[model samples]
Target: MFVENLGIVLALTGAVLSALLAGIGSAIGVSRAGKAAAGVCTDQPEQFAKVLILQLLPGTQGIYGLLVAFIALSRIGLLGGGEIAALTISEGILYLLACLPMAFVGYFSAVAQGNTSVASMAIVVKQPTQAGKAMIFPAMVETYAILALLISILVVNAI
Candidate 1:
């Protein structure tokens, strides 16, 4: 009965979830890091540059999510090619499943990265000279997001 519509539903669901979850994570993560940055900046105005960079670290997840959503939408003909209604149930489901890893991982990693950045901000607060080293901690969390992005892109392209 709903089979004809299921394809578009699944495809749209995947695209929406990928962007929505990742954006939420980035928003929360950036907010937390921004609060930490504000606290640090209030104490030491000179640390603003370092803290700002750290605070922005989690934003990459949102960009990754957007990329995946764009690719998925394009591949499934929602953004280009034919009409979105032309997608098959199997193809839509495949796209949906392919997006799950990035959606889940991106959300969790961004939040974790934000927390890590906040902790790293403490390091920057005390040891200003070690800001470069401190940045590495939060940067490490980005690995998983990038991996997830890569996998999602590959899967979307493969489909």
Candidate 2:
């Protein structure tokens, strides 16, 4: 019983932590992108479409985290079960460790992507067609987040 409860606790903790990390990352990224967009709009108000896309780039991480959490929850049977057993200490520890990389990577990647988007936005204002090219940086950062998420999921499943 205790072991099941521990599993539930660890899983919930991991889900919440992952969500928080992704949410915070998106928030920061959006904020940075918003600021940049505002700056661009001041000079070129017509580039709204381009700027909006740039601003939205950083928001994807939050969705990724949410998906991961949902996957984890489903895997652990937390949603349907009335009570769960606690995990073994080793399992709990493993779960925690697995969650860390995604949280950290998602956070910093979003921030970095935000910065990249800001720079890209500036470029887009000058050359609208180049916007796609500008997205490469954020896409690159997203790869790391994806990798982290995959690792976390694999680890969780293994436990």
Q: For this target, which candidate reaches the highest TM-score against the unseen true structure? A: 1
TM-score of each model, paired residue for residue: 0.95, 0.86
Residue-wise C-alpha lDDT for candidate 2, range 10-126, written one tens digit per residue: 767887777789879989998999999998889888888788888998888887777667766666666667555456666666666777777777788888889889988867888
- Write the residue-wise lDDT of candidate 1 on 1-159 in tens digits: 589878878988988888989989999899999999999999899999999999999999999999999988887777866775577899889889888878999899999999999999999999999999999999999999999999999998898
Please report, in order, the local distance difference test score of every candidate based on alpha carbons. 0.91, 0.79
- Per-structure clash totals for the candidates: 0, 12
